[model samples]
Target chain A: MTPPDRRRRALLLAGLSVAGLPLAAWALKPVRERPRLIIVGGGFGGAACARQLRYLMPAADITLVEPRAQFFTGPSTNAALASVCAEGDIVRGPAALEALGIRWIREAATALDPVARRLRLASGTVLDADRVVLSPGVAMRWDRIAGLDATTSERMPHAWLGDAQVSRLRERIESLRDGATIAISAPANPYRCPPGPYERASLLAWRLSARRLKRCKILLLDAKDDFTKRALFQVGWDTLYPGMVEWVPHAKGGEVLEVDARRNTLRLQNGSRLRVDLASVVPPQRAADIAVAGDLVDESGWCPVNPASFESTRHAGIHVIGDACIAQPMPKSAFSANSQAKLVALAIAAQFAGGPAPVPRLVNTCYSLLAPDYGISVGGLYGVVSDRLSTLNDGMSPLGAARELRAREAAYAHEWYEQITRDTFG
Target chain B: MHRLAVLALACLLLATPTTRAQDSLSLSCAVCHGARNAPSTVPSFYGMSTAQIESALRDFRSGAREGTAMPRLAKAMSDDEIRALAYEFGAPVR
Candidate 1:
C-alpha cells in the first residue's frame, strides 16, 4: 500500500480497539469521544474555525454552513476595483475546505436552537451537533437610510459582501465620464471594516488617474470626524491622487441622512444636499440577523461572548466569533475573524478531549492599500483578562512615513493577503 | 523573616500599575507564539529561555531584526514589557 493509505489505515486502527486486543495497545489509543462541531456562516471566521478544528481534532466531524458557494474576502476587494487583482483572485470556494474533511452545507442558516443543540436551515434541514459556532458576520441596516432596500441596492451597490456587488461597482466606476464625480458614503462606527471606505476611495482614484481622467473627482463623505489610519490615508491621497480626492467629515455635513438613487443625490444630516454621478452607500450595520433571531445578541445588537473561549454568554453549547460577536479592541476585519476563530476551535477541541481550555491571546492586523504600492496598517494584541477581552499592545503605521517605508508596507500587505487567505481557506 | 519580606515584595510588585501593564503585554505575546501543538507557520516561544526571548524581542524593537510584522509591533511595546514577555514564555512549564 502507498504511504498515505498506510497512514490512514494506522489512524483507523488507532481509533478503534479490537475486541481481543492487547491491553497495552488499547491503553495507547485515545479514550476521549470525538464531538461534532457545526460552524455556521462559512466566511473568514467559520471557514478558518472549521480548518483549524480539522487539524486539532482529526477525529471530530466538522460541518460549515454558508449560503454562498464562494466567498470574496473584503481585504483585497478594493484592489479588485483598481484592476490590480481580478475579482476571482479575491474569491474563495469550498474546494479547499472540503479537502480538509469539512462537510459543506451550501444553505443559509435560518434559526439556531440552543436548547435542542440544533440549527434549522432555510432548506428545511436541521443540523444537530455537540457544539455550534456562529460567525454570521453583519447585516445591513437598510431601514436606517431613506430609499434604501434590497431592490434599490442594485442601482447603488454597497459592494461589501460578495463579488457580484463588487463587480457591479467596478463596472460603474469604469464607465464614468471624464468629468464625472463619484461619492462614497461611509457608515457610522462599529462597521465591518473601519478603513474600508477610505480604501475604496483610494482605489477608485487610482483607477481614474490610470485612465487619465484628471477632471474626474472622488468625494469621501464619512459619518465620523476621524477614521482608522486617517493621517496615513490623507497623506497618500495628497501624494498620489492629489486634488482628485476630497474628504468631508461628519461635522462638515458629511453624514449621509438620505440617498436618492434616481437623481444620484445625497442629503446630509446638516441639511445639505449634493448631487453626484455615482453613489456607493454603505449603510449602518448590526450583528447578522441569525444572531438576533437566536437571541444571542444584547441591547447593543452584537453577541456577548466569553473572551477565553468565545462561547456565547447567552447560550450554552454555542460559541460566537467574528463580526457577530463583541471582540472589543479587535476590529471587525478578516484577520481578526480568522484569529479569533482559531482560538475558539482550540478551546472547543480541548473541551472534548477532557482537558482544560487553553486561555488564548489573540492578534489582529488590518492593512489598507492607498495606492498600488502605498499601504498603511493598524495592529494589536488582545487577551482575556478577568473574563474580558482587553487590548495589551496596539500600533498603527507611522504618520508621514517615508515613501520607501510605505512601499515596503504595501508589499507586506500583499504578502499578508496571500498568507491570511491561505490560512483561512486551507 | 526574610521569606515573608520577599513574599510581601513580590505581592507589592504584582499590584503596581507598571507591573500589571507588563503582565498584560506579556500575555499578548502568547497570542501568536503560545500554541505548541497547533499547526502554525509563525515561530513559537514554548521552549525558549528568558534571555533568548528577551534578546530577540529587543532586536525586533530596535529594528535589529527585520522583516515580517515584528519590528513595528515590537516598537509599540516598551523594554519593560518585552522583559515581562520573556519571563512568561521562558517560565518552566508546570
Candidate 2:
C-alpha cells in the first residue's frame, strides 16, 4: 500500500476504535451482575471479612457498612471494668479497615431487603449488593431484663462491650462503703461479652479485699448455671478473696426478675428481692436490628448460619457471623468473630471468583481477671467438619491443671490479650 | 493482515485474571541451628515447646529478646497470623 493511504487508513481505524470503546465496555458487562459482597457491622467479624476479602479478591467490588466510626473491642474492656476508665481505653475505632482500602461509614443498618439484595442504612443510604455478611454483634433482649430500656440502662449499666459503663460501674463501686454489697446480674446466654461479669467481679473483689478487708462483696447473679471459664475462675476467686464473691446460679435465687434502678434493688424469680449499691444487668441480646428485620433469624431469635462459610440459612448471599449468629461450642468472643469473618470472606471470594478456600481452622481464647495476677483462660483450636465446627479438644486446656500451671496459663493469658489486640488492630 | 493481528491481540488481553499467589517463606535452620529437622545445636521447630514459642513470640513483639531472625520475624506477625503459623508448625512432634 502507498505510505500516505496507509497512514490515513490507520488514523481512521484509531478513531473507530475510540468510538467503539463505550459499546465494547457495555457488551463486556456480565449478564448477571458481578456479585457485590457487603459486610455489615464492622466488629471483629466484619473487619476480618473485609481484610481477607481485600487480600483474596483485590478486584472484586467490596463494601463494608458499619454504624460506628471506631471499634473498641471487648478484649481490653474486660480490664477497664477494674480501673477508673471509660470507653476511651477500650474503644479503638475502625482505622484498621481504612488501611486495607475497605470503605466504612458511621451509620446503623436499619433494614434489609433479602430478595432485592439491598441493605438499608439508618441514614437512608441504600447498599445494594449480591452477598451481605451481617455481624451486628448483639442487641439487648429487653424481655430478659424488665424495666430496663436504653434510658434505664444508663442508670443501671450493662456496659457489655464499652468502656463508659464499666467506668461508671467502677465509680459506683469505689464510692460505696466497705460493708456495702455490689450486685452484678448476668443476663441470659448470648450477651455481647460472656466472661465480662466474672472478670469485673474478680477485679472489684481484688480491690475490695485488699483495701477494705473483706468488707465489700460481689453478688454475681447468673442466668445460666455455668459460664465460659468456671473452675479456674472459682479457684482464683477462692484463692484470692474467699467469701468476697458469692455466685448465685439460675437454679438458686439468682434469676433476676425485676430491677428498680432508682431504688437500687433487684427482684428475683423466687420472690425475694434485695437492695444494692451498684446494679449491672447484662441483658440478653439479638442480632442487631438489621438481622432481625430481615427475617434472617430462626425462632430462637438468633441467626442460624452454615458453620463453615457462616452463610445465613435464612437468606442466600447473606452470611451471618460473630455474636449475632448462633455459634455453638463457641462463645461470642471477639476471637471467634474475627476467625469466622475470615472464613466467610474467603468463602464468598471463592464462590464468586472461583478460588479455593483454605481448610478452615478456628481458635477462641477468653481471659478473665482474678486479681489480675491470677488470670483464668479457656481456649481451643477448632475445625469445621460435616459443615459444622468441632472444637479440637486435644490441645485446648490441659484438663484440671495444677495451681502453678493455672498461674502460668494466666500469665500466657495476659500475653495472649496483648498479642490478639495487636493482631486485630494493626 | 495487520488489522487481523490487532483484533487477535485484543481477545488475548480480555481473558480473566485468575492467578492466586501467596508469599511463601521458609526457614532453613541447618547452617545456624543444625540440619535434618532436629537442629540439636541450636533450636528446631519441634525442639521448642509451645510455651517456649509463645515466649519467643511475646519477647519478639516486646523487644525483650536478643536480636535474631526469629525474634525479628516474630515481631512482624499479627497475633492472628502468628497463631496461624504457630498453629501450622509449632508443637512439632518428633
Q: Please report the candidate that would top TM-score against the real structure.
A: 1
TM-score of candidate 1 to 2 decimals: 0.81
RMSD of each: 10.2, 11.3
Model 1, span A1-426: residue lDDT tens: 135644765666666555445444434333335677899988888988898789788988899988888867888888997788888889886567998789998899998877667889998998887789999999999888888887787788888886588888888988898999899989988889999999999988988888899899898988999998888888889989889899999989788888888888889888989898898988889999999888999998899998988998998879999998998878999878988888888787767665556656677888788888888888876777787798866778888568887787787787677667766775
Judging by lDDT against the true structure, name the best candidate.
1
Worst 10 residues of 2 chain A by lDDT: A24-33
Tens-place lDDT per residue, model 2, A1-426, is: 235644665665567688874334333232233456788877777776777778777776678786666655677565666662454656666667777777777778888987667888888888887678888877778776777777787778877755467667656666767787888888777677788888878878876766664777789998889887677678778877888899999888688888888898889876789898778777777777788888889888889987777878878778898988988777888877877777777677666553455556555656565765665556555666677877644122334556665565556555555444444554
Per-residue error (Å), model 1, residue A197: 0.2
Q: Model 2 TM-score?
A: 0.75
My TM-score estimates for the predictions, one after another, are: 0.81, 0.75
Q: Supply candidate 2's per-residue lDDT for A329.
A: 74
- For candidate 2, the per-residue lDDT at A7 reads 68
**Residue pairs with clashing backbones, model 1:** none
Candidate 1, residue A186: how far the Cα is off, in Å: 0.7
